[model samples]
Target chain A: MMLLKSESLPIVSEQDIVRARQVARQWAIDLNFKLIDQTKFVTAVSELARNTLIYGRGGFMLLEAVEKDLRKGLRAVFEDRGPGIPDIEEALKDGFSTGNSLGLGLPGAKRLSNEFEIISQPGEGTRVTIARWT
Target chain B: MERIPILRMGDFLLVTIQVDMHDRLAMTLQDDLTRQIVASNSRGVLIDISSLEMIDSFIGRMLSNISLMSNVLAAQTVVVGMQPAVAITLVELGMSMPGVRTALNVEKGMMLLRECLDSDDSEVEDDAS
Candidate 1:
């Protein structure tokens, strides 16, 4: 299994989203991921980064290339210590957002990835993990 | 978060959107553009995308939707001055922005919009006669 990783910088602002996507794109290219898979990775990364800035006060993201049973894939984890999500289920629903959001960030991220999971507790924090196979 | 209306040339209205075009703002822009096209019964509209740094799939879909909505309102929509990097990202994401004409600069975009508007006017005149 080939492994690669990156930690999100503290400059977690909306503008940083573009930089995060660039990193993800480079990682995908290095992994020799398929074009479609690369797109999914970039899109998922963008959404997560945006979430980190918008919802999660600030946080870090880790990305890794994984291989299991001869199948290649990628995994990403975004963790934040911001005001945690009070309701995970409602958050997953499209158009359900706490901020003045279109509510497409989480749901759209889920649609772009093959696997998605979220862990959050009120006043604690939120962590989101997503994976997609190439 | 300030939307600055930079110019209005003939049937085209050019504005600079200086905030993240996500969430409610994105929706608002789409709705407003659609309404403007319908109200004016414009032949064509041009939107300047120079100040926009990033556009996610949602925004891309909205742009396409706006274009289609304009058509339904009997108008054409064109997007101008998208950065190359943003374009590359959009392409990689498999976003097919439909019904929108893309141009390299505002001048070129305005030229196209004018031509579309002129042709539309001629057609309307022909029908009237």
Candidate 2:
């Protein structure tokens, strides 16, 4: 696996979430990803970015383009220093939102990506990474 | 500062969401639509989302909210022109968007709204008679 390109954008406000989605869409398109793939990736980014802003109490998103064995991929990592999830298992469950949302962010993002990962520590922060390969 | 515009079309209120709405913008649209439905005394609401590339859970919930609120205000809400990819993504996101009626396009949505509104009005007329 090799990183070809990378960029970081702040996720402190609602507008940042929209920017995150647009950046993800552009990255997917640049990788020649199909329309469906682009939409799915962008939607996943929207969910995770919102989570980073609302749950993570504002953070940043890292976008990376990677090449692995001639296969290209796009990866996004959301990092936040807000109060971390106390129960990762429960939080991942659909309809289990601590906030008033529909509680689909974590699980939905996982479904939309080819690869998904989460790391969180109470009172510390949380980080979520997702990738889709072509 | 940008807000989604709502247009009056006969007994219906039409909103074409042409922007990639941020969270606050989506919420503001919801609020604005709800108020407009009452002020216009609209019998139906048609929302065109064909320009939207994606509908995350937040936006999906907002759409559902708009549908429900419109119903409570004695209006029928029809969301139309959802991209196939967005539809697939919404379902995969675990949001079926229950309680929200959808149409294939603006034309179909308008027809459905008119059909439902007509039936509703006739039902009220029968009660009055």
Candidate 3:
């Protein structure tokens, strides 16, 4: 397994969210992921990117392409310096929402990827890294 | 704020989404659809999402909200032409859009709406202004 070439982009605005999704999709396509897998990854990127902007108040995302035993995957890291989640457990709940949303963002993104991780501090910030295998 | 256009045909309203759905755009669409439904007295609303390949939980909530609002205003909402991948992603997202209706395409959606309106004529008549 190896971490291949990667690209980073700021997630301060709505357009950045779209940019992340597009870049992730292109990478997934280049890696020869299935159409459904591409869509899954793109959707996950969209959700997490939005969370970074709205909840995290702005962040950065890294699109990293990786390989394990010759199998390829795309990894995205969304990091923000905004107010972090106090309760990771509650935030992952399907119907829980703090911002007038469906509360599906975190969990849904988790479902759409093969690997998901989150690190946050109440006063510091939050960072979520997700990876999807091709 | 980008606006998604709403077209009226007889007693039905048609909306074809062709752009990236940012949060602001989704909110705007929800508000616009409500206003259009009220103004046109539309009995059915059709949303074509075949062109939209990606979506998130926020958009999912907005779709559900639109369905709920249309119901309150005496109109039926049908979301049609969802891409297969989008369908799989939505199901995995766990936001099944509980109260919203769906169809494979615009033609089938209109048929479904017509059937619903015909079968529930009395309810439509009683509630619709």
Candidate 4:
């Protein structure tokens, strides 16, 4: 079993979201994720990164590789200290969004990954974790 | 989340895409349109993207996917009204949208679709005779 870890530099803009996705793609490829799986992983990361910038103002992303029950996968955790989600349930709804455009950020990220978890509080902040197994 | 109407004119389905189209809901719109084109076996499709402020690689890929999928279902897909900035970004990103037709505006896109449909009908007629 092998474990790989990396931390993203703090980013606060939309362009950084794109850069974060590029970093995530490289990591996925280095870990031998299938092409389609890599695309899914990148898409999920893009959504989260965009959210971090649009909603949280700025944040850091952590990438980790894990092995469990003979299965290997990639996991990402995005942490932001912004105005936390006031309502988690509402945020998870398919069409629920506080931004312009379609409200598919959270739900779409959830749909693209194997596992997704979001923990947030009104005053504290928001943490989003997602995993995709190949 | 605003539900943009799918405008139907003749055999073509026209959809106007707005800004912030990189979001997941926009991707879902692509999926929905693909399904619609397949199930209905439409003759043509024109997606107006004039309102989009930016187009990322993912959204470009989705548009390409829709174009390819529509072709398999015997439909022609055209993308119209791409902002210059969006176009430059797509090119800079080295994004290639194969099998997708692009036009400057909806009017031009409609004209191109008409020509494609006309040629297709002629082919069918020739095959029948």
**CAPRI quality of model 2:** high
Model 4 DockQ vs. reference: 0.06
lDDT of 4 by residue, B8-34 (tens): 777889999764543456667877887
Q: Which has the better TM-score: candidate 3, or candidate 4?
A: 3
> Model 2: per-residue lDDT, tens digit, B22-53?
98999999999999988988889999999999
lDDT of each: 0.74, 0.93, 0.91, 0.77
**Model 4, residue A118: displacement in angstroms?**
0.5
Can you list each candidate's DockQ?
A: 0.17, 0.92, 0.82, 0.06
Which segments of candidate 1 are over 4 A away from where they belong? A1-8, B1-58, B61-76, B79-129
Kindly report, for each predicted structure in the order presented, the TM-score of its chain A compared with the true chain A: 0.90, 0.98, 0.98, 0.92
Q: Candidate 2 regions off by >4 Å?
A: none
Better of 2 and 4 by TM-score: 2
**Worst-scoring 10-residue span by lDDT in model 1 chain B:** B1-10
User: What TM-score would every model get versus the actual structure?
Assistant: 0.63, 0.98, 0.95, 0.57
Error of 3 at A78 (Å): 0.6
Model 1 TM-score is: 0.63
Residue B64 CA displacement from its true place in model 2, Å: 0.3
Which 10-residue window of candidate 4 chain B scores lowest in summed lDDT? B88-97
Question: Which run of 10 residues does model 3 chain A get worst, by summed lDDT?
Answer: A93-102
Instruction: Report the Cα lDDT for residue B44, model 4.
Output: 94
> What does candidate 2's lDDT look like per residue over A24-105, in tens digits?
9999999999988899899999999999999999999999999998999999999999999999999999889998998999
Of the true interface contacts, what fraction does each candidate have? 0.04, 0.93, 0.93, 0.00
Q: Candidate 4: how large is its RMSD?
A: 12.1
- State in Å the error of residue B84, model 2: 0.5
